[model samples]
Target: MAKQQLAVLITLLAFLGPAACQQQGLHICFNGWLKVPPLLSYLLCPPGSRTTNPPPSPSPNPAPPSGAGLSYDYYNNNGSSSYCPSAESLVKDAVKKAIDMDPGVGAGLIRLFFHDCFVRGCDASVLLNTTTSKDSPTDTEREGPPNKNSLRGFEVIDAAKAAIEATCPGTVSCADIVAFAARDASSLLSYGKINMKMPGGRLDGRVSFANETDQLPGPFSSLAQLQSSFREKGLSSDEMVTLSGAHSIGKAHCGFFSDRLPPNPSTMDYAFATELEVKCQGNEANMVHQDYQTAYVLDNKFYQNVRANKVLFDSDDVLKTVREVKQNAEYPEIWERKFEKAMENLGRIVDVKSRREGEIRETCWRVNGAGY
Candidate 1:
């Protein structure tokens, strides 16, 4: 590993401890790949890839899987009144305050939750309940259940609750707790000036999706597939790309798009595909997926790579309409503005009605692990 990367990895280990680092693999837990470290998370990524943080390591860690599961642990775990959010009126008040303070989570994760609920039916199972131990292939590929990294949103919310609980214990609802947490996390990224609305009264739904394995987007989607997927979830074509900006902070495992790279090239742009292959192959699997922290910086680099035709997926390339414009004199300007607007708008889809039909899972795994 590069000296700088090694330093970052070591620093993260010191910070998050060996136990937390052990449950590193989000996809495959193979050997040789670097364990997902807290600091150098971006090392495994192909600079511009966008599906997951790190890939599976050759010798994956042995930490207990992370994520929620069906069991009513969230709303009913600690104690109904203690863990649940406050009454609907209090939730509304808290949400109103939260949006102004942090809009990213309020708009992003909360909006994501709403979108998931509307399409597949309300079920927080769309949010990961816990780290799973089953094979990925076993999933139905339907909507909900395995939201992939969407569950990470819970991590951000947990942090927010740490602070909120200090001020108002048992009074805030878990649903509002997440809403506020999302807002705060967004403020951390947007400098707290973005326009956000907090929809309150999202009482925690105690039900999770029966198929919680699908619902999440992947790295290999075609532009059309992505458009259709997003549209199905109530998002527009423009919003799909905008939400992708969320990639500005996340990472993807190389395996997610290894095909997009050279040697095993798919239908991706040539230059981009070649570069991605080189980057993916060059890194040691152990060190690649082992790094997950560096994946969250929002810079112009991701967009530029897409412009260079070096992006990993067809979905990413579809946003490159700027390169396809032949005669329109206003294309570049319009594209730039639209891209920014979409991103901003993505952060603004907040409202109380957002939680119409969803229910939080007691356990994230399966509603009933038996035959149901």
Candidate 2:
């Protein structure tokens, strides 16, 4: 009777699929011929029924499928460990060293990672320089107005890459290096408050175009615009809010947000607006901290400031009106936890639709054999 029931259950699950099994409040475990749901496991298998230990626990960070042409163990596959204790540690140390030399580098690294991943699946194409004429409107990604003078930390990435190359020698991909540096930069800037382990194995992309810069969300985007932008990148609304917390540690150029100053601005704090106007008067290049309370720290103060309408960017200010984000704003601890998970998700999204399409460039700035 038990054998008959087990066979029937297996047949049912065969057609139901994993999603259906989960919806029925049961965990699916595939073991060759036997498709056992957790609820029925004890009854079917009994005590020591043709078994060799229980199923393994789910991996905390599972590698994407091989067809994706990327692996979390990319460094291991490339023998990076044979060269050093751990390539990730080497990269982390290099990032810390760079930050030590320039305290303001964290924000740029974070932004660089964000921009790179958003446009082209984190292939590190953003690092490529324009092969076309410099004056041409169709310059490289770095030459776009949104990034022309604002995006930074390329030198820090180059430094970290040089250090990694000295140890691994063509083993690490620039995309993975950028991801690692960004993770380390966030943790270092936040005083070890937002650290998360990053998985490696990303490849570098060959193409970079200036016009693609328009895909990135701007400082003046509205709440709906921000949501649409993040969604287009496969990030959730919660993730969007969590990632936006990065604004806590960065500064913005006056030209980016100065328009909010004139014509009787209402969303901004009176004193803050006046200060910005005075500081930015006739000088669009002046920069100001995004979060005044904890400009250098990478904490939840950005959320607090957004709630108080003290944020620098119009897009950030609009987050308060987002119901889900507004609710999370009142609880910084929740945001921190969500932020960590969201950042992990951010790294994962960099892998989607990005395999076998590019190569690991010998140098980040130019394609291999392209000549200086």
Candidate 3:
């Protein structure tokens, strides 16, 4: 019954769009209920059914995910047997050092975490022990079709892991380190404006399969296909659009978006497509920035690009057609704030109750030796 009601609510949300819902005074509670005014409460939350906690007031310091064993500073917990006081700071420092040498590395770090979580619940499965140099064929997430020869910034993770391990040996999990580095990278990339207190204490998983890469949405996904992919991951369509803002700092190989080349005058901008054709002509290896105007910044400019029909992917281009989402490009301070919340929700998708039960890999790549 509750499932049916939730399904019905989702259908309504799909029809109404988030902005329309907001205009109608419909509030989406984090608990998955639509918190409405007393007049509409019976229709939304229902009488005597599950109740949602009131939304938290916006604060510089937000609370961590509940029951996650995660905290703003889990490694430094004085009561813990293995305590590394500066665990997070070490990651931030490493991220800064790497980004200083190559600013593009910061975006790569963010993409790394996004890909990892989408594939295997943010367990660092994306960081499995497999590399281009290895001739020994291994079936790991790193070897997956979507990830092979694509994901970068592995050395950045390696540097952070080395720093954490040197300080506390076996205290921090590689998964937590990856999450922290991604958080630090985004903070640094956005000049500290987009900051979130990332939860710690996530454990590394021992299993990683190449086939699981299907969980990731492709560049060519239609609007419906993209929504369904995000839906499967417990994200809303609004959140999907919000997360797409990260593409402000992203790039894609030409081959990935070749179908749009020559441009479909309807969805994509013709002048932009012609320019890309010249830029990528005869070179499948060339990379195109998701937001050509500000390829290095993390902001809502990606939405503006979509509004101009200058985006690279069909998924990104479709965002502009949604009235609620297109508003993210104009007066989008609200969109930036929602981006942070959506990211927090993305990080929360992984269940952490069994974190202590999972192994802590000695290296970000390989699992720890026997009895970890």
Candidate 4:
């Protein structure tokens, strides 16, 4: 009698579409229905819903499983509204003012955030200056080959940090300030098209190393390599492709992709290759727009170009062949929605509590105690 009732429930769920199943808060959670008891189904998911996978358990007060001591309320000051609002507004206003003076600064801020996050989990380590002798081979992450002469927008972050320190003293961390600046820049550069609410309270990392940048994916990175890099940071392949849309704005130094040109042409379009060759003229220092069409706008045209085989970097081109990205390439709405969510998640990658293994740097360039 119990078996018959379970079979009836399964058949009813099958008849109900995913919409109905979701409305009833029920999920299938397994393939072999007979292996799962009927009571288990009710516990896993509510009735009238069918799903192939179990829903993620909610953690109302989650802590970082890695013991990094990060939390959503790491910066909370017991219902003190003044703490976050003042810092957030100051960072946004500073970034907006900077971008207004030079629109290109927006792309620089986005890239700066990536360079910082990819190396040392977005702790504003990239903003650190070389403390040792200038001629030394090993300096800071900012001086590394992957970053030197390539990364920009340090001054913008510096400006925002200075402004914030004036109002809030050492209450706001430079890491959080950098994150907020990047979010503001993204929204402003896209002309308010790609706005995302960023969570703050990240503590500043004290250590910065040039060698750690080996984790960063280069322009020549294969799809597998890019996926592996992002996966290590708790991001999915879909998110990797979504974040690559940032190429929609920014310029790349010609040296980064010159190897892809001429007799050994890679995935780049021939006409586009010829144009880049003319623009760059074999100069390593010369720069070209990552997306010539709508180069200053943050949009899905980057993916469209990738699909058409017109993007500059091999890494950007390969995103089109990824199954999940390929399907979403044509739908701007879908990609934009996914990209926003991914960006939000990316912002959380380095959210460490100030109380543990971190500090709120009085200045972005050096640790709080270390003298400039």
CA-only RMSD, every prediction: 15.2, 17.8, 12.4, 16.7
Model 2 clash pairs? none
Candidates in order have lDDT scores of: 0.40, 0.69, 0.70, 0.70
lDDT of 1 by residue, 70-144 (tens): 222233334554355333234334444544464333444544443434333333334434323244233322223
Where model 4 places Cα greater than 4 Å from the true spot, the runs are 1-84, 131-138, 263-266, 351-355
Model 2 stretches with alpha carbons more than 4 Å out: 1-73, 77-85, 131-138, 263-265, 351-354
**Cα lDDT tens digits for candidate 3, 1-372:** 597896787667555443443332223311211223333433433322222222222332333334255566777779886589888888889999999998788888888888887765777878986523233246777776567787888998888889888889888888788888888888888887788777777778766767566557666545655665566566777777888888899678887667677788887888999989988985867987777887777888888888788888766777776665668888667887887877766666564533544677788887666332
- Best prediction by lDDT: 3
User: TM-scores of all models?
Assistant: 0.49, 0.76, 0.77, 0.76
> Candidate 2 — worst ten consecutive residues by lDDT sum?
24-33
lDDT of 4 at 88: 74
**Candidate 2: residue 90 Cα off by (Å):** 2.0
Residue range 135-165, candidate 2, lDDT tens digits:
3344678976567888888987787778778
The TM-score between candidate 2 and the true structure equals 0.76
Q: Once model 4 is optimally superposed onto the true structure by TM-score, how far is the C-alpha of residue 80 displaced, in angstroms?
A: 5.1
Give lDDT tens digits, candidate 4, residues 163-242. Answer: 87787787888877777788888888777777786677667777776655656776765575677667766677778888
Error of 1 at 259 (Å): 0.8
lDDT value for model 4: 0.70
Candidate 3 global lDDT: 0.70
